[model samples]
Target: DNIRLSIFVPIRDGLCNWKLQMVCKTDNIPDKERTAVFELNEGVLGYTFLKTRKHQIEFIDVSNNNNLPSTYVSLNSDNSNLINRDIKGVLVVSAFQNGSVAGLLAIDTENVSDLSKMEDNKLHSDALDWIIARSKAVKWIWRIKNNV
Candidate 1:
């Protein structure tokens, strides 16, 4: 048995609209019952809330430039509204073109009861390094593509 990994990428232009692209891979895991990992590398320029619904509203955003942090909104409430909650177990990585990155690494909702606790400078620093490494790898791949 193997664990599956899901990668979601949303691309957008200048408007606050996005199209989702998903990729799933299952060849990297040796154990099946461990845990599935989902990595979100988002370069969101801005986001707009669409409709004034109580639960499960749409978020329109152009994810070309990294300007906003990737967030996790819970949709399980008594009122059936999608409100921000302390449900952990999601990682968000935001990478900017100017060589900067921000992320929410470990989201322990039980310990972190509020949004303010999720904002940590150390996590941002680690995310920056991860983004930089990825940027370099992308550039190398692009060069290879050009050579071919």
Candidate 2:
């Protein structure tokens, strides 16, 4: 089994905010996390956001190390229990709209083999590609043109 976690962090002039947009295969996520907000430079999520490509979509496996990576440390004191422990791989990709990076997406998978097998399956791989393509086509209309 694999955990599908999608994160979207908007890059703005003010405090960068990270949110847990969606999740699959897990229901025990604390309510706070579902509505949790994090500064862009604050946790593994922020780190991924800042490190991703600015314009083009790029996929990166942040961690594949067998041991726990120190980067998994949570910024929230309440989450001191360790949020992403034993995370085998983290897929980070850029999202764009109108030639600008709208957000960054990160998926954490505990079982890398499961993901690999899925990637090998044509249908699954096509679905994954569709998701990536869709990410790059994001259209952010929340901001007024020229901040009018």
Which model scores highest in lDDT? 2
The global Cα lDDT (0 to 1) of model 2 is 0.47
What would the TM-score be for candidate 1 when compared with the true structure? 0.31
Q: Residues 46-79, candidate 1: write the lDDT tens digits.
A: 1112111221112122122242335523222331
lDDT against the true structure, each candidate: 0.29, 0.47
| Error in Å for residue 49 of model 2 | 1.9
What shift in Å separates residue 57 of candidate 1 from its native position after superposition? 22
User: What's model 2's TM-score?
Assistant: 0.51
Winning candidate number (TM-score): 2
Cα lDDT tens digits, model 2, 1-148, are: 3656554545334355334332322454444554444565545555555554543332324344334345543457644343555555555555555554455555566676655533344534454465567663333421331131
